[model samples]
Target: MAKALHPTQVIVRPLITEKAARLAEENKYAFQVHPDADKTQIKDAVEKVFGVKVVKVNVINLQRKARRTRTGHILHGQRWKKAIVTLAEGHKIELFEGV
Candidate 1:
């Protein structure tokens, strides 16, 4: 059987890009997540780890980009999925508290 994953495992990392930062300020927690993870898993994980109620979850699959390497060779970046989790009103996560 597949070993159970902790709440932390559900969320690989909180994406802190310019766009993600703005969403975070608005109580939207965005993260790069496992491609196979579903909405229910994401909701449970976010709430369990952050101790906050999840209002909604939006997921997007981002394709890897093809770029040129230093040696004039073509390479592909990694493909990953992203999840935008909206927390209940008045709920907040402290991950960006000091940043």
Candidate 2:
């Protein structure tokens, strides 16, 4: 069985990007979550950390991609998971407010 994860451990960091900023306008925020964390865990973590009601949670498994270096060496990118969290109406996370 997998060990339980704390709120901080579940949510790695907020994904601050152009696309993410656009989604924030729609009451949606993206976060880089632990690979082992599920949608329910992500939902709980966001709500607990941000003190906001979560309307929905969506997760994406971003597979590692191959990259070629200048020396003709092949490398693979790190595999990570992303979570898109939609907050309830009238609620928003303060961290994303200034972005």
The prediction achieving the highest lDDT against the true structure is 2
TM-score between candidate 1 and the true structure: 0.85
lDDT (Cα atoms) of all candidates against the true structure: 0.86, 0.93
Error of 2 at 32 (Å): 0.4
Question: Across residues 1-99, which tens digit of lDDT does each residue of candidate 1 receive?
Answer: 334566677788888888877888888878998776788888999988889999999999999999998999999999998999999998999986544
Error of 1 at 12 (Å): 0.8
lDDT of 2 at 3: 56
lDDT of 2 by residue, 1-99 (tens): 445899999999999999999999999999999999988888989889889999999999999999999999999999999999999999988888778
Which ranges in model 2 have alpha carbons more than 4 Å from their true place? 1-3
- lDDT score, candidate 2: 0.93
TM-score of each: 0.85, 0.93
